[model samples]
Target chain A: EPEVTQTPSHQVTQMGQEVILRCVPISNHLYFYWYRQILGQKVEFLVSFYNNEISEKSEIFDDQFSVERPDGSNFTLKIRSTKLEDSAMYFCASSKDSNQPQHFGDGTRLSIL
Target chain B: AQRVTQPEKLLSVFKGAPVELKCNYSYSGSPELFWYVQYSRQRLQLLLRHISRESIKGFTADLNKGETSFHLKKPFAQEEDSAMYYCAVLGPGTYKYIFGTGTRLKVLA
Candidate 1:
C-alpha cells in the first residue's frame, strides 16, 4: 500500500533557528494536512492544503509557520523561528478527497534546544 | 465547537478478557466518528469508521446518537491489541478532525 513519507525521522535545532519538515504525501492524494502532538497530548490540527493553497489552519499555526508544496510531490512545513514549545511529533497526512480517510506518515519528532 | 472526549487515560486487561474503550463527542449536526490506533513505534492508522459500520481485527464500534458516543469494543482481547487508541470526529464541512486525548490499552498475557 502506498503511504505518506516524511524526511528526517527526528530533527534537533536550536531555538530561534529556522526549521523545515518535509513530507511526500501519497502519490495520487489531493488533500494534504499537517498535525502535531505534544508529549502526552492529543493530536492538534495545524493546517490543510488543497488546490495549491491553504484551505484551513488552526490558532497554533501562527505567522511564524508556513506550508508549501514547492514541487508536485513535496509538502514542506517551515517555521521561521523555532521555540521550545514547538517541540513535538509532527505528522503529515493525505487523502484522495476532503471526506476520505487520511493516511498518516510515521511522523517527524522535532526537538528545539 | 467540535470536540472528542476519551475519559480514560489508560486501561489494562488480561488476555482473553473483553475490552471496551469509551469515546464521546460534542457536535450539533450529524457527526462522523472514527477510531484510530497506534501500535508501538508505528504510525497512527484508522481502525474503523462509523460510516462503514464494519468490524476490523475483531473490534467493532457503534455510534449511539442519543448517548453521543462511539465506543470501541472487542469480545476477546489479545496481547497484540495493546496500543494507543484515539477517538476523532470529522468537522462538518471543514474536513478537519478533532481528536481525543487518547487511551493507552495494555493487554497482559
Candidate 2:
C-alpha cells in the first residue's frame, strides 16, 4: 500500500532558527493536511491544503508558519523562527477527497531548545 | 467547537475477553467520527469509522448521537489488539480532524 512519508524522523534545532519539515504524501491524493501533537497532549490541526491553496488553518498556524508543495511529491512545512513551545511530532496526511479518512505519515519529531 | 474525549488513559484486558474503549464528542454540526490505532513502532492508521457501520478485525463502533459518543468495542480481545487508540471528530464541510488524548489498550495472554 502506498503511504505518506516524512523526512528526518527526528530533528533538533536551536530556538530562533529556521526549520523545514518535509513530507511526501501518498501519490494521487488530492487533499493534504498538517497536524501536530505536543508530548502527552491531543493532536491538533494546523492547516489543510488543496488545489494549490490553503483551504483551512487553525489559529496555531500563524505568520511564522507556511506550507508549500514545492514539487509533485514533496510537501514542506517551514517555521521561520522556532520557539520552545514549537516542539512536537508533526504529522502529514493525505486523502483522496476532503470528506474521506486521511492517511498519516510516521511523523517528523521536531525538538527546539 | 468540536472535541473528542477518551476518558481512560489505559485499559487492560485478558485474552478472549470483551473490551470497550470509551469515546465521547462535542460538536454542533453533523459529526464524522473515526477510530485510529497505533501499534508500537507503527504509524497511526484508521481502524473504523461511524459511517461504515461495519466491523473490522472483529471490532465495531456505534455512533450514539444522544450520548455524543462513538466508542470502539470488540467481542474477543487478542494480544495483537494491544495498541494506542485515538478518537477523532470532524465537523461538516472541513477536513481538519480533532483527536482525543488517546487510550492505551493492553491485552494480556
Candidate 3:
C-alpha cells in the first residue's frame, strides 16, 4: 500500500520560531489534510486541501498557520511562530478523492521549547 | 455540533474473550463512520468503515442510525488486537473528520 510519509519524525523548535512540517502524500491521492493530536486529547482537524487550494480549515488553523502544496508531491504545513500549545503529534493524510478513506502518515512529533 | 464520543478511555479483555468498544455520535445529518486503529507507534490504519460493512481482522461495526452509535465488536480478541482505536465521523456538508478521544484496548494474553 502506498502510504503518506512525513519527515523529521520528531521536531524540537524554540518558541516564536518558524517551523515547517513536511509530508509526501500518496502519489495518486487527490485530497490532502493535516490533523494534530495533543497528548491525552482527541485528534483535531487542522486543514484540508484539494485542487491546490484549501478546501476547509478549523479554528485551530489560525493566521499563524499555513499549508502549501509547493510541488506535485509535497504538502507542507508551516507555523510562523511556535507556541507551547502547538506541541503535538501532527499527522498528514491523503485520499484518492473526497469520498475515499484517508490514509494517515506516521506523524511528526513537534515539541516546542 | 457534530461530535464523536468514545465513553470508555480504556478497556481490557483477556485473549479469546469477546471485545466491544463503544462509540456514539451526535450528528443530525447522515454521516459516514469509520474505525481507525493505531498500534504502539504505528500510524492510524483504517480498520473498517460503515459503508463497506465488511469485517477486518475479525472486527465488525454496525451503524445503528436509531441509536446514533457505531460500536466495534470482535467475537474473539487476540493479544495483537491491543491498540488505540478512534471513531470518526464525516458529516454531509463537511470534509473534515471529527474524531473521538479514542479507546485504548489492552488484550492480555
lDDT tens digits, residue span A16-66, model 3? 999999999999999999999999999999999999999999999999999
> Interface RMSDs of all predictions?
0.6, 0.6, 0.5
Chain B only: TM-score of model 3? 0.98
Query: Model 2 over residues B1-109: C-alpha lDDT tens digits?
Result: 5778999999999999999999999999788999999999788999999998989999999999999999999999999999999999988888799999999999999
Ranking by DockQ: 3, 2, 1
Candidate 1, residue B12: how far the Cα is off, in Å: 0.2
Clashes of each: 0, 0, 0
lDDT of 1 at A57: 95
After superposition, the stretches of candidate 3 with alpha carbons farther than 4 Å from their true spots are: none
TM-score of chain A of 1: 0.99
Q: Quick one: best lDDT, which candidate?
A: 3
* Model 3 Cα lDDT, one tens digit per residue, B1-109: 7889999999999999999999999998899999999999999999999999999999999999999999999999999999999999988767798999999999999
RMSD to truth, every model: 0.6, 0.8, 0.5
* Predictions in order: lDDT: 0.96, 0.95, 0.97
Give the per-residue lDDT of model 2 (tens digit) for A1-113. 99999998999999999999999999999999999999999889999999999999999999999999998999999999999999999999999999999999999999999
TM-scores for candidates 1 onward, in order:
0.99, 0.98, 0.99
The first chain of model 2 has a TM-score of 0.99
Classify candidate 3 by CAPRI docking class. Answer: high
Candidate 2 residue runs with Cα over 4 Å from true position: none
Q: What range of 10 consecutive residues in model 2 chain A has the weakest lDDT sum?
A: A36-45
Candidate 1 chain B superposition, TM-score: 0.97
